[model samples]
Target: MKQLLTLSIVLTCLIVVAWSVSPGSTNAAPEWQSYAPPHWILGPIQGADGSEKIVLNNLDQITRAKIPITAFHFDAPDWQSCTGNLQFRYSDAVLDQMRARNIRGLFWVVPLIGLNCPEYQVALANNYFVKDAQNNVIVTDNFTGHGSWIDYDNPAAVAYWRSLLDSLRARVGNVLGGFYTDSVRPDKRNGVVAYGEAYALDLLDYTRTYVPDGDVVFKRYGVNTPSDAWLNQYAHVAYVNDLPTNFSGMKTGIERVFATTPLMPLPYNEFSGFAKAAPDSETYIRRMHWGAFQPVMENVPFGKQPWDPSFTPQVMQVYRYYAMLHRELEPYLHSYDQAAFEDQTPIFRDMDASRYSARLGNEFFVQYVTDYTPAVQIKLPPGVWINYWNEAEVFKGNRTIMYRAPLGKEPILIARGAIIPMRVYSNLTGHGTGKSEYALTVNVYPIDHSTFRYHDTTNGWLTFDVKGPTRRVALCTLGNVPSEPIIYRIASIAKKPDTVTEQNGAVGINTAWGTPLPERNNKKAVGRNASGWYYETNANRLWVKISTLGTDCPAP
Candidate 1:
């Protein structure tokens, strides 16, 4: 018998575990709100000096492949030099191309001024740099040697830095999406309490003025930052410091970052660490496979393409497959993002972080450990779950099961009775759908009733509720039909439906008593055809398709 813990017990343990880093943190849970990041964010991790030609090349290839990406993060020479000198590369043509492709541009910014830059002179004249005990300018040395950090405690200094950012935005034709604020507190020797707070306030205020919907990401600026709780409310995302390319380091970093969930999910990256040694093709793919299931797939184009160049086709194929898979999961991922915003809960969670156990749960867990001599045991909540990768492998919940997971294929489970809405692939440039088509393929596990809300940037909030063979899908703002011929492909069902009927505010479908598919066996149960409904007796699964365009609705 497996050791079973109640929901309250699990939550209480999570709170206690989370208390290690964030002591005296409030227990007041906030209401969950919806949050969806821009479709994709691409950045170059290694080459900060990347030119427009390089960006254009990537954009062209990604476009041809129809890989979904919405925003580009500019670093190094494109925005500033590694030496902290102002470079600000890129031209009108660059901005125009990004605009044509419907991709927004962003770059890195820090609160440090190079001693040799013209900005330093202006700050020196106006006393904008942080002062020492003797009222002398305090200088710090970093990768970009001998620079003065922003003295945001002074009002005049804040205005000067804000104006500098304003000028950059104007220079870029205002096409930039947002910024990745770097090391707000690069040095702590000054002992300034408002170091990160000052920059965060200005950035948030600027976002509200210009791009209200844009995201602001920060490093070393939030509750995760020791002795700091300032930027937690303003920033949208945070990433752990760069770690080694080895598996243990990556695992430890993930645990640490996800453990500090003051708000939002931590975006995982392996490019920086991997770029140093440029690991073999197998290692690269493994690293990427680990990232594919995370909350946000931060595809930083830093190192050489993960796969060996000799096998370019294979590399591209695998990369494109995972990218598209991530694209296909937007509807599900964004729903959890919203839940995090309003409720202060993270969807990409760990079942137990303090003990360094691999068990993770947020309706599902992905196994990263390769060795399974004794088989990896996972503790699941009380319910039935179907393996997302292999629907045939179903687990009765409230128990621990030792299961072996194969490489490159992580086991993700969908709870029974859960209604997940998915948009079938239309194209890559426009995020799966090429046109304004309201078509969805909803996978319904064996369940009594379940409701899911689809939030689209253009379509707004659409609530979809499914009960048995009946489904209710409606746009919150519009009473009439949002799209013609709305289709629902219900999969992994237990009943065979013969006919489907349309009606006002609802639709009904009945199963047929057809023979199971020929391939239906004990473990592997069902496969559906487009012709009609099909049933698999051994696996107890059925598949059905329903349409609502030409079918007539009866009188209310």
Candidate 2:
């Protein structure tokens, strides 16, 4: 009898799990915000010398991508060979330019402070450097001999570093973003893992002390960098100096952040053999696959290489455009305060795109991980929700559908009659609409016993709308031509009882904290006195996110 009861329990559990599957509401949680950047990292990567600079500005300078970014970061500088030295540090005029162009200034601080420069000597003599077990100050040869590290824990070091950061803050103020640390702190005893985590956390505490509250990011990853899986210590925005696969061990690092807080993953193109320091473009472009999934994207084009296929222009442009789109879709998302859950992989490290696009609050907050090929499903909330990326319409009056992302594409859709600033890129709907348009085939399903209907604005046509039969509905490119295939997803908002009752793990869409939006829309559009999301993604998942939706930063 006990054995039979156990079997019955197992079957019941499966049914509950199946019923619990939200085949309607996407994201389902209130905190999963889109991890896309609105700006692009502009850099003048070099070749051997002048005349050979890989000019990147050659592309469409006037045409803006999804989000507009005016910031630029330099990755390489040959001090020894160059006969001239024109400091490009932040200036008052530069800061003004940033405000005018809506750009921020991010100074990449390399770990080249202690090699042989008098700066290192002066700092060390003043007891500003990290010391060894024998009380001797630590010093080592940075690939760049001029590079050296001071004891981050030392007061003198803190003062000096803050002084530098202050200079930037003074100039850029609201626009000055902290791109802290070039590489992980070097260590041997506890090793890089421990050192990286501890060192990064210390830096955060140190920065928050001076700037009190400002945006900070970590760039130029090292072999000693800590796993992002638990980067509550280091800043959420990562200014990577290495390849994306290197982060494979931390597949869900970004998700982990959004599950709790908002974060960005900005990767620098560190591929260039032109310079002895940077790697080649192929390796850099190859990182695009992983980089695209991140909220932010960037590349290091050093040695002054012109933007070309050899420099991975296609990859860079696609990433830049995609990132912008991701950022633009932010306002409609129900993230930061949303309760997000993940099916944690049981293995050591596994590949999982889980789900990207989820429909909630009449909008599609979607995601596209490594595998854009599998047939996926999404749930929708009552009423209408639209895909803003591509002009695809979906409604949840009835059931759900398994939708597919067009090949190598991500579209942002809006509700049929929703007021939006911009229009989707493509509006094609239905079969034989166009062969090159769709990539992944999506099958929509219903739940409310109603019907699921969607329209394509690409050609301004009503693609399909089902009335009764619970049959499979499919949408894809209509051609036989061989094209690279991938997957994109759609989801719906989970339903709740109509009665106003205590609802856990739920966040309202377009919700604001502190004082709500004003009538005339005449408000400081910033997170002011609030910590909505301070400069970068924090290390919290959805549940904790909703509870602390806004910023807690002390007002200046």
Candidate 3:
């Protein structure tokens, strides 16, 4: 006889697990505001060095290599006519190409207007530039040349800056994703107006208005900086200040991420560091591993191409591996980002300050190796941790242990009751394509009971609950009906189940585990209606497929 269970029993003991989903009318914010940043943000290559040809070439290289990147960042020189003019230099052809590929164009902007540009004279005539006590325009020589800072303190100056942004957006059209605001330092001042926290905050807020739907405004702040408190609300994404391109720089970048992620949202640093000479192959791969787990995986290489002959082939291999890994875990990362938005909870939680370790929500814990040595000492939190790379290997928590993390690998431990939801790998995010259906794989490591609240662009919200006391495990689905079939891979099962049943009836146990059916003649192939159970003796894992077509489950 089928066992009957009460819904309240499952609801009471289950740990809540939430994963990424499509934005719905859950709050007062815009629907797009609920969306997280893309998994990979590419470019600003060589800093302030950008051209139409350069941007196209990099995109071509990345696309050919099958590396998925949703956004491309153009440095200050790309849009500036004479530095800070806020002009559009790229032709319509460039914008069309980006739009066709569903790629977002992120252009760099600043508060200063170059003295050589006509816009500067207009601002000066209108008293829009910050002025000294002597009533003279405060001209400061920066990287771009002599420029006057726009008086964000003055309403007229703010309106003029907004007009410039409006003009640029009108020219670029839909491909203009957002702006990258740099050089908003707290130290800039004149005798009358000071560009401090309020100025910086207002500038960012104004810049965010220009960003189109499903885009972001990348700001540079929050590493021992003065405006750390306001960054969370102002910027969509916050980046660490530039660091040297070396092992020490990687360590500092990690420390900075530890410091900023607690207060800010989507904190990241440029992969391979930003200063000094280009990173060696070792530093590049190691840093890339760390970047894969960050809230945002950004790649801004300095010197040669990532696939250039200067670096070893392993560098590109590791880069591609981690890039795909980041995209695969998008659903997982997006869930935490959404949580940080709804509640003020930190996305990445620090486990130990002395050790470079942190937790990504409640699912996984990561320990980074800062130096050249592959041996790492990890202090685990209280629980049972399963090695993500090797599911069979498990360890008890609250004790420190030495683990080997060679190149191309890092220490990632999954909690015992983690319910990870993932999607198939793709070279693109299918942003403008309007894709609706997606195949989902839900990995469950059941202990007592756990629930996963999964979300996506197509399927609004679906809940998966797993409960077990001993060897018997029961899985249930609630909320919206899934568009496609779901494959549940239950891990750590010591033996094959005697019977697998759903609401319909008994589920057939396939004796041909890991073997393709006659129709599909591939090793890891199954039919669309492949709803059954398969047990792999070697791994002690059970695979079950539940078909959603013409089936009804309880709604949440």
Q: Over all chains combined, what TM-score does candidate 1 have?
A: 0.74
What C-alpha lDDT do the candidate models reach, one value each?
0.51, 0.33, 0.62
For residues 1-556, what per-residue lDDT tens digits would candidate 1 score against the true structure? Answer: 1112111112222221222234334343211122345444322221223666776666667777666555666653345643344345666676786788667766666677888788789889999888777998888776424678767667777778777777677777546677665543345633544565556556645654566455665654232132334334344566555555555555665565555454434444433243354544444454555555665565553455443364436456656665666656666666566645544555655445533233222444555442222345677657787877677778997777776654445456677666665554654322223321244544556355665655554555555555553332221112233242233445454544444433432444552322222322211111122222334454444433333332233221
Candidate 2 regions exceeding 4 Å error are 1-67, 70-96, 110-112, 134-136, 143-146, 168-174, 187-202, 209-213, 219-230, 233-236, 239-241, 244-293, 297-321, 333-556
Please provide, for model 2 over 1-556, each residue's C-alpha lDDT reduced to its tens digit, 9 standing for 90 to 100. 0111111112112111111222222222211112112222222111121221211231223123323443434334331222111123323454454466555444444433534444556666687665668987655544423444545455556567556445545545665444445554444522645445545554544444444333345643355664543332223345444333322322333344233222222222332212334334433333343333333434343333324445556555654554443333232121211112122111111212354333322323334333424433654334555554433355453345666644334433344433211111222221111221223222222222221122221221112221211122111221121122211121231321111111121212223213221211111111121111111112111110112211121111
Alpha-carbon shift of residue 467 in model 2 (angstroms): 20
lDDT of 3 at 196: 40
**In candidate 3, which residue ranges exceed 4 Å CA deviation?**
1-48, 185-226, 426-437, 456-462, 469-472, 479-485, 493-556
The best candidate by TM-score is 3
* lDDT for each residue of candidate 3 in 1-556, tens digit (9 for 90 to 100): 1112111112123223221221111212222234444333322212224676776777777777766666677765555667777788767776776677677767776677888899989999999987777988878785535778777667777778878877787887776666555554323432222254344445444434545243444444431132543454334466786787787888788887776665445777776677548888888888887787777777765555578788999898888777766766777776666556554456677545468788977888998777788788999988999988788889999999999888887898999999887654542321101111145567789887787776653665666677673565666666666666666667887876666555531122222122221222221342234555556677777666656432233211
lDDT of 3 at 307: 82
Error of 2 at 166 (Å): 3.3
**Alpha carbon deviation, residue 191, candidate 2 (Å):** 2.1
Q: Please report, as a residue range, the 10-residue window in candidate 3 with the lowest summed lDDT.
A: 1-10
